[model samples]
Target: MTTISDTVALLSFLIAHPGITVAEAARATHRSPRTLVEELNGLLMCGVPPYSPSDYIGLTPLRAGDDSPIELHYASHFSRPLNFTPPEALAIKYALEHFSHGVDRETLAQISGLSAALESSLGGKAGAALRSAGRGFVLPARTERMRAMIGKLMQASEDRRVVEIEYYSSHRRRLDKRRVGVFEIIEHGAHFYVYAWCELANATRHFRLERIRSARVLDERFDRTPPERRDAGRMAPLFGGKAKERMLVRLDEHAAPDVVDDWRGVEGVKIKELPGGRAKMDMPLFNPFWALGFVMSLGEHAELLKPTSLRKELQGLLKDAIAAHA
Candidate 1:
């Protein structure tokens, strides 16, 4: 969904460069061409008349001899706290506003104190909701300096150079300096993490970027694995385990859409509409316990049509749960 800020940013871009094409806009904004077109359509909803055709593409002034609706003074109003492109910033803001309340408290807390500007703009209700949902949890404010430091760390990681950092680990309650061989930046839920080999620890560890008090790039460099190898390592499971099994299941018509959407991450998952208002799906199981929990959440709408062992296992679990409740 397009936010007011997204619409404003696009309008600002168009007003700045009057005769730019969709492809050009996409490149400038770091957004997909299709997305830029969609954002332009949304601007049309707000009474901005933009012109785009196969040959010539640009936004014309709504009426001649009028100043652009977007003002330079108001530009900062649409600017996001994070280094996200307009659409991504808007999406994250929207999610924090709407979907965060029901999520885990720790997760909500991590996002809550990320930006003071965001908190103030969200106003009382949203702020109160976040605090209420995330009781007894607090996150350190992410200031502009911290963001800048993190950007530098990211660059160092890409260059495969050592980074010296003054870091504060809340759990440890001490500030320390160390050089790190950076591996990857991981976004777990709402938090940003640097997973790297700590020189002090001589082991891989996850460090929250927000907790770094200071950072500097070191002159030393190291040869890192190629992109393909790095990607494969990232894809590997955290826990030692055998390869996941694949299974097939059937869903009732009432459950088809939910199943399809939920199983989208499972590789090779296919859903086919069946007779008598049923749908069949093939799914990959990373861990049977996790898979069973997900399938059981669907209740009676889902049925295991194949893999009799899995069906029997789920049945036994269900029986045990009922017995425990009884």
Candidate 2:
């Protein structure tokens, strides 16, 4: 999905410059040149002209004249509103009312356009109940402190500034203060992570937002690396560089789909059907830890078919488990 900021940035760029090249747009937007080219090619998606190398930027009217300011008309089907619909707007207001702290009455009125009487009628207890229910029902609590921190981090990221943070790592059971160059915030499974280049570790790492004890924007800045290089370096180790070996497993028919879906992208997976309603799958092995655990999870339904060492390791683990349990 194109984020709201991306769309706004693109619109602002067009508004600023009457004529601009793809390269120029990319530089202005802090987006990759290739991505800007792709966006230009798909101008028709937004009901704009089939943008050419020589075409002027901005929303110019669909006419032959070159003197007029661009009066761009987006098709109704293509254009989405910057403002929320009634239900969405109401939901946002209710959420903010229920969960936000450090938000005063005037600010709430400004945000929700709700009367002071109505806001007060909701009361502190009602708001607390709403918040508790929202959390119970998987609705996120939009805390003011979290929003403020995220806003600061986003501004820092756009400005290419380093952030100093006191972070707590659950895995290592340690709290450390360090400076990190923030790149992107990624949402996964109902939580957010700040994926960044950790200067202290001299590598790319993901820091969970909730786990960050405290953060402060540092005056020091660093050059942002290209996104592709960051992605490659961060993802390559999952498959163990270039020297990893491929492993194959045989599964019963009932378990095949689950296994395939679970391990879809670690490496290329090949699934084959056996004559007796069983399935065989091939996948790359980064290390024996993951493969052994995966096969053991299937109980008796899965068997390691290749790489004799892996099968032997699994045999030992299974025997140990059985002995312990017995």
Candidate 3:
């Protein structure tokens, strides 16, 4: 459901940018126009529940195709935009700061103004909440040139342009060049990344922004099917595919108090508390290195209870390490 403020914002934006097509509006609002249009069309059936033609709001699409002009009528109720509540205002303050990090100079100044307005307008606990919230996020310190590169990538995403980049591969420990179709910039695990289709890998990949040595925007246009654009909200796997193995492990309950809590709500990870303060966990093994590191850190407190082959592999790695140290 769209919030009143969100619906109002959409209406206002459409009015300001008259004759704007669905795609253009989608890009500006950071929404899929397909979904935006559904929300817009919903406004037509809404109003005082008389359900009469006069009571219902009217919306007419003017042009053929989705390149249509929307006409709004019987909508005097929202003449004055609504004000945000204290919590909402604080939320906006945080959101503005989150986005201001990557915006250009002009937009950064505008965000600062909006932030100031929110602070002054808020009072009491709301102001405290805003102040209490800190920059809990850490973005890689980027040079001015890198910030400009981010701007170029954003433009390429909206304009469907491909980009050629010289990226430093951490795992390979080498610099490699690739052509990628820019999809979107997203933040995950305290770092910003460019989610794109890599022509070199022929797969969707997320490249950390700081790892890109250089980039050049290409003039050629690209068409991204709905499936091609990956969602940035989820933490992308480092290996770039589905988990290949499932792992079962047991923990001495007294040893790792927060371990169960840490994975409590995660999908595909389940825990069962035992009678003697022991717990068993079953989860998909996204990465063997990650799983091994965690288990090894626990020492005698943790045990791998399933997939004997994986345990054997870990033992082999441990033996190799011991031999090297010896």
Candidate 4:
């Protein structure tokens, strides 16, 4: 099956090598000639979101059928080469530098060459940052087993295959086996999640990748469109479902500065400053456990003002901890 990633790579290849035949494009992209033709046809409907006719990535063959060279009639945006803004250039440079650390030496060389070309092309401050960016972010290495699990889930998603997995549930604090129809893998907040239809719960759930103990792709395939995709272009939040509740907290003078510095412009978060360096914050209650941990981290300087139930739970936990220590 030609995955979305493959289709994107195919589009880039077609744009760059515009007159290549189907057979030639297949050879270059490592896809079968038949699959190449199918993907080309699929691209007819593929475009930027809010996809109108003009937003589509247009292309046509120089001659009829799949035998001839292809010609691209891309959207207006693709008409010109990309011109990266200063921040964009810096982000690209930092990404390349970070990625180079995790790749093989041969791949590292290619990344280094690409970085050099970008720096040379975009001179001055951007160019200098690319050369001296020096590890702006560091990522922990993935274990071989975790990498294999991620690869398996990705293939299952592409093929619409069912998979049985041993998952460690943080809420339950135990391992459980469940069968799921894989959808897609998504990265959020520096973590990877496999969004899938869980047979046990009979609901769509995002399973954290790191917590999956093992995965086995079954021979069975799923035929129905994923619930969120049934409406096309509509999907639930990747970090679990939408928040159904809100949290209101009061921050004392000691914690006010940190809260403002950290969440000044974050969406769904509202902060009202008061006299004497205090502030009231209102935000979505995505997870109670996370809220408890966050409030605990802030110690006595932060207080949960609303959601009486959560406030009670926090008091109980604090009492238990104090009693245990005593």
Candidate 5:
């Protein structure tokens, strides 16, 4: 099935090469002629919000057959693309730079080249932001194994195959084998997760790529459709299932800025400032392991105040950690 990204890319190509034949367009897009024609027909129904007929992409073929040349009548409307504001440019530039950290050298060079092209072409406050020397975010470099695993899983997902994965379940603190009907891979915070139907859990689950010890795609096929896209404003990226519990935490002055910045646009995240630069953060707890790691990362600056059971568990973890050090 053609995704929105695929359709948009095809539209962009059509806009660039008007009156292109179906055969040539199919070759250029790496799609079969029949698939290209179907996608073009689907585009006939696509448009921005408040979608009047004029707002829809207009396509007209020169003849009645699939082999005929096609024309995009309203191509002029999309000829002028939107410009990035300064902040938008800076955000993208910074993200690109940070993304360069874990990629192969050839990919890194391409990213740098793209950054330079954007910097030189933009020319203004936006351009300056792209040209800025400092990358605003930092992340540890990823191993080649992690990169390969992600790629393999992505291909498996596209092929609608069942994959056998040896995954490390944090809650179980052990590696276990699972048969998964892979859907889509998504990046949330610093990690990549495969959203899939898990036979082991008998439900849909997100498997963190880094924690997957190994994976092998099975010859068996899956009939499951990909999940519908969640609304970004209401959902947390890392948590796919409905949250069954809530937790409250108190943050010291030093941690408040980072917490507020990270959770700013996410719905159901409430942060209220207390006196002396401190704050209270109340959020849904999807996974105890994730919550534990998050609070532990904050160290002394953050305190988990609610859910006495979890607090005791945190205390036990601290004790174990201290014992290991001793």
Candidate 6:
């Protein structure tokens, strides 16, 4: 069955390609010929407000041996691409800059040209905002090994294959192996993550690409499951799990600026005034493992104040880190 999103995309495609043949339209949409006809016919009922022939969208269906091609009409509003808002323009610019790392010269030039065009369209405040947007989510330098592993996983995702990977679990502070069914790759906060179904966990899980020690695409094919049903796409980079527990920490003046910016407007997150030059923060601990690492990153300037278990866990992590360095 064709989804609403698919139907909308199909209409847009047809509008963009006037007089497109049935088979060609189906091929472009990755839908069967019959299904494409059904969707196109169904779309004919949708219109702006009134249920009349003039208001409703119409389609000319192509039959076998018909010289005239199928044409979808009555949507001049969607004939052109949508323009981006200021925030949207800024986000697109940032994403283009971030993903330009491994792109070829021609693609890079095209991106630059698109950016210039966007800036020109979104003049005044929008253009100034785009120029002043802080550098966010900088992609880290990738080794040849990481790039090769990423390439293999991309193919595995496309082929719907299973892969065996030796991964470094930061939460566990150890290396483990698992067989994962490729779902899709998502980039966020300057890092690449794979949302996959783990046979071991028997659930959809997100794995950071850089954390994989070794990867081998297996000859096994997996039963495909959509990421939406599992909520895998909603997983945050650092945190996963129930996310019911909260962590409290105190940061000195030196570190408060960055910490506050990082946690601004977060639900259940608040900061309290402190003596001298310090503040206390209370926020949800979606993943204590990730929480511990973030706290440790603040060095001596920050201290975990509440939730004794997290403090103890950080203590143990620190002891192990010291011993490892020793």
Predicted model with the maximum lDDT: 5
- All-Cα superposition RMSD per candidate: 13.3, 10.6, 5.7, 10.1, 8.8, 8.4
lDDT tens digits by residue: candidate 3, 158-259: 888889999986545589999999877876655678888889988777788988988888888878643544643223333243445678999996655678
* Whole-structure CA lDDT of model 6: 0.75
Better structure of 3 and 4 per TM-score: 3
lDDT of predicted model 5: 0.78
**What are the runs in model 2 whose C-alpha is more than 4 Å off?**
1-179, 187-194, 200-220, 227-230, 237-243, 261-267, 286-292, 306-326
Error of 5 at 83 (Å): 15
lDDT of each: 0.61, 0.63, 0.74, 0.75, 0.78, 0.75
Which candidate, 1 or 5, would have the higher lDDT against the true structure?
5
Find the number of clashing residue pairs for candidate 2. Answer: 2
| 206-322 per-residue lDDT for model 5 (tens digits) | 888888999999999988885576322213434543456788999999998889788876666778989988999998876788788889889999999977799999999988998
TM-scores for all candidates: the values are 0.36, 0.45, 0.66, 0.60, 0.62, 0.62
The per-prediction tally of clashing pairs is 0, 2, 0, 0, 0, 0
| TM-score quality measure for candidate 4 | 0.60
Give candidate 6's error at residue 320 in angstroms.
Answer: 5.0
* CA displacement after TM-score superposition, residue 131 of candidate 1 (Å): 22
Instruction: Write candidate 2's Cα lDDT for 76-97 as tens digits.
Output: 3324334333343346556655
Selected candidate, larger TM-score, 1 vs 5: 5
Instruction: Give candidate 1 regions above 4 Å deviation.
Output: 1-185, 188-228, 231-244, 264-267
User: Which candidate number has the best TM-score?
Assistant: 3
